[model samples]
Structures are given as C-alpha cells and as structure tokens.
Target: MSSTFETVAGIMSETADIPRETITPESHAIEDLGIDSLAFLDIAFAVDKAFGIKLPLEQWTQDVNEGKVPAEEYFVVKNLVSRIDALVAAKGA
Candidate 1:
C-alpha cells in the first residue's frame, strides 16, 4: 500500500477504534466499521487533518444524515477508496 493509504487507514483505525485490518479499501464506514454520526465526524476530522483537507462539518453531517457516506458503501469499499485516493492526490499534488 502507498504511504497515503497506510496513513489514512491508520488514522481511521485509531479514530474509529476499529482494527486496521478490518478497515480495508472495501470496509464500509457505517456498516463494517460500525461508526455512528460522532464516530464518522471523528473519522472525517482525522482524515482532514491527516490529509490537510478542510472537510466542512456541516456538509459532512448532511452527508451522514442522508446516508451518503462519501462512497455510499453497501457491499464494497472501492468507491470510498477512490474518494480517498482523489483526496490524497489532490493534497499531494
């Protein structure tokens, strides 16, 4: 995995208190990680800080409340991973 992926996963694991192993690119933040609103906020905050992306809190809340978890996770994690990858690339570039 790239350092960006490792860093994202590591922060996610620490913030959500989920095992890093369980937080694959396919792991659903709500279903697989079992994260609630606060937990999701925590993850978003951590991700923002870790990747230098200023994710808006209000937008995040709206997304979570509307069940639009960044990637709309259901059975796969590819969408979420792609979002993260885009964020990481933007930050790095």
Candidate 2:
C-alpha cells in the first residue's frame, strides 16, 4: 500500500479503536465498520492532526445534505487516503 494509506489506516485504527488488520482501503466507514457520527468526527480530527491539513468535513456534510455527494461514497477509507494525499502533496509536505 501507500505511506498515506498506512498513516490513514493507523489513525483510523487508533482513533476508532478498530483493528488495523481488519481495515482496508476499500472498507466502508459506515456500512462495514459502523462508524457513527462521533467516531467519524474523531477520525476526521485525527486525520487533520496527522497530516497537518484541515479537512473540509463540514463542507462534505453540507454537500451530502445538498445531494452533491453521497455520504457512503465520501466515507470510504480510500477516499480519505486520496484526499489526504492530495492535500499533503499540495502543501509539499
């Protein structure tokens, strides 16, 4: 996998208290893992701290509510990885 993927999975595992071994890039944050809103926020905060990049979680929530993006698609682990990677790269981190 990628370093970003590893870091993301590690953060998710630690923050969400889920087993790292069971987490995959494709894992569904809600359907497969039952990540509640609290857990999702916790994960998002951890991710922001880890990557030193502010995640637009509130915007995503707004988009979801506005029917721009489905919540399920946004909550995928790979999506997090991709977003983090992009943000980090853009920052030249």
Please give the TM-score that candidate 1 achieves against the real structure.
0.67
Off by over 4 Å in 1: 56-78, 88-93
Could you estimate the TM-score for every candidate? 0.67, 0.89
Residue-wise lDDT of candidate 2 within 5-93, one digit each (tens)? Answer: 99888887888889998899899888888788899899889888888898888898999999999876678889878887888898894
lDDT, model 2, position 88:
85
Backbone clashes in model 1? 1
lDDT to native, each model: 0.67, 0.85
Largest lDDT belongs to which candidate? 2
Model 1 over residues 1-93: C-alpha lDDT tens digits? 666667767877898788888877767667777877787678778878777776555765577678787436322345544556676678788
Candidate 1 lDDT at 55 equals 52
TM-score (C-alpha) between model 2 and the true structure: 0.89
Give me the overall lDDT of model 2.
Answer: 0.85
